[model samples]
Target: TTQPPLDDESVYRIFNKLMLEGKVRAAVRFVTERGGGGVLHPSAQAEKRPPGVTLLDVLREKHPPQQQPCEEAFLPCDSLPPLIDVDITESTAERTIRSLSGSAGPTGGD
Candidate 1:
């Protein structure tokens, strides 16, 4: 049996699933290859694999999530800015704070 062409909702669902699984390149590929033409392979990687495995499943599993979310900084610790010790509570504005607009007090009209 042949699979029907994917609709917008189905396309979005597949794309989101790949993205959330942290497979950006695969997600883009899926949209470009499958979405652009709706030509899903009849049986991508069917032989020598599990019964229900799919192309998307293989792409997502190619890279583990634990290894995907790190910045590309040479010295990661040095890239971060130092924390500020200063405190400014909104309820009690610091004395140094001044209204950016007209003076908080009434003008000469006061």
Candidate 2:
């Protein structure tokens, strides 16, 4: 069924999960695919950091990619990303529920 587009919370949630799971590469890729454009991509830089790359880890502690380096890197602000196979929770509002079941949006007049 259809759902609403991704929001800042959605992006941050997924990003946080990936970081906690130690899926640094996956997190970077996820952000990139979402709208990060790659230059400001988050990096464990495992090779560059030489086993002490805790940038994402540190950011994980800060959270939600707001007013931070990691946030600027991969967190999109200008545009919405294309929906991926994200495990969307049942947080969608009533409008989405209605639309998915084929009900149109509100009519202008009864």
Candidate 3:
């Protein structure tokens, strides 16, 4: 089955949800893969911050840094990193189907 591309807005929604759930640490690891080769190519980075203030600082002010740093905060006016397409190979898709079907070819069962 072909997977639909996750638009930028979708990524922001997911990452923003993670932030609200207090799961992202330091920086959101936005990974993307092209051509459906099943390889992830994450290259997004947070923009540079002004002197005396950092992403951590802003996060702290908003949510009081929970042990780990918040990866994405969905700041009021900051632009989000670009989103890329992810592809799934036929073999990988088949494997996933098998696993979900509980076939466990060779391993018997887990």
Candidate 4:
């Protein structure tokens, strides 16, 4: 009796397992330089080693929530109007008096 052939996922899983065990020598032979020089084989005297960071680390770093300044403070107010209809009289007219005073308010040199 013959067993069913391995599927793509099974082959990939086996390859990854071998790679982790440093048994996939031929696959790991193509070591391209970081600065796009070219591929080179591991040195003859080189010892097999596991990667410094696992694939999980790379995926975590890539998919981590992006940080933004003032992100926590800026909550979306969905209850507020989608479009503002500004009326001059309805809006508070607090003309920043410092602009008129030519002091450049808080934004200019002393």
Candidate 5:
């Protein structure tokens, strides 16, 4: 059987499994530039890799109530920007539309 394409969800599940299997160091490095441990926020304490403790274990210990069901992850380029910029000039917009139409196919006006 063929393997499914490695989409974001698959990547996330694989990472979670790796972390659960005591590969937290590898998991963190995959998402961040820091290795082993690092700071997540300016005010937050720096992460420490305690003996025999995984990052996921630490997180669950700290925020048991906030734990959420796993969802899909995505590459940075896979999503659209939160905000969009468009030129509001009517002439510019019209010109762009006309140009696109010209390239799409022959028009009846020909």
Candidate 6:
């Protein structure tokens, strides 16, 4: 199934909700998984932070740093890296389907 593209507003909404709901960790996971190119496409440097680094760390370093309650704070605006472009080529899907089919045959049922 084809996935619809997510807009910037949707991303911001998700981010805001995740933070407000005390699900920052879940928000981070959502961004890491879907926030790429067509998604959030957060800065690459954001990933350089140590493993123990909290989502706040990524927010502070990538976006403009700001001082606020830990729970309400997010990555700084300036530190936020530009979003990367995510291109989903048809060949990529075809290759994946072929691999999953487990047999190089016309039926593709195997």
Judging by lDDT against the true structure, name the best candidate.
1
What's model 2's lDDT at 100? 42
Our tally of clashes for model 6 stands at: 14
Clashing pairs in 5: none
Tens digits of per-residue lDDT for model 3 on 17-62? Answer: 8678865541154433321333223332224755556555665567
Better of 2 and 5 by TM-score: 2
**Residue 106, model 3: Cα distance from true site in angstroms:** 29
| lDDT tens digits, residue span 3-79, model 6 | 89789899789888998998776688686774443222443434556666665567775788555679546655656
Give the Cα lDDT of each candidate: 0.67, 0.64, 0.56, 0.51, 0.60, 0.66
List model 1 lDDT by residue over 1-110, tens digit each: 99898999999999999999988867987888833333357446555679888766776778667645457644446466788897678744734344322234333121
TM for every model, in the order presented, reads 0.30, 0.28, 0.25, 0.23, 0.23, 0.29
Ranking 1 against 5 by lDDT, winner: 1
| Tens-digit lDDT track of model 2 for 1-110 | 99787898998999999999988767887878743332333555533454766667656756765554665567557978797886656666554655542124444221
Please give, for residues 1-110, the per-residue lDDT of candidate 4 as tens digits.
99796777876776677688876543343221122333334432223435465545555657978878686788877696579786765223445434332224444432
Query: What are the clash counts of all predictions, listed in order?
Result: 0, 0, 2, 0, 0, 14
Output the better candidate (4/5) by TM-score: 5
| Residue 94's lDDT in candidate 2 | 53
Query: What is the TM-score of candidate 6?
Result: 0.29
Candidate 3 scores a C-alpha RMSD against the true structure in Å of 20.3
For candidate 2, the TM-score is 0.28
Error of 5 at 56 (Å): 34
Q: Which number leads on TM-score?
A: 1
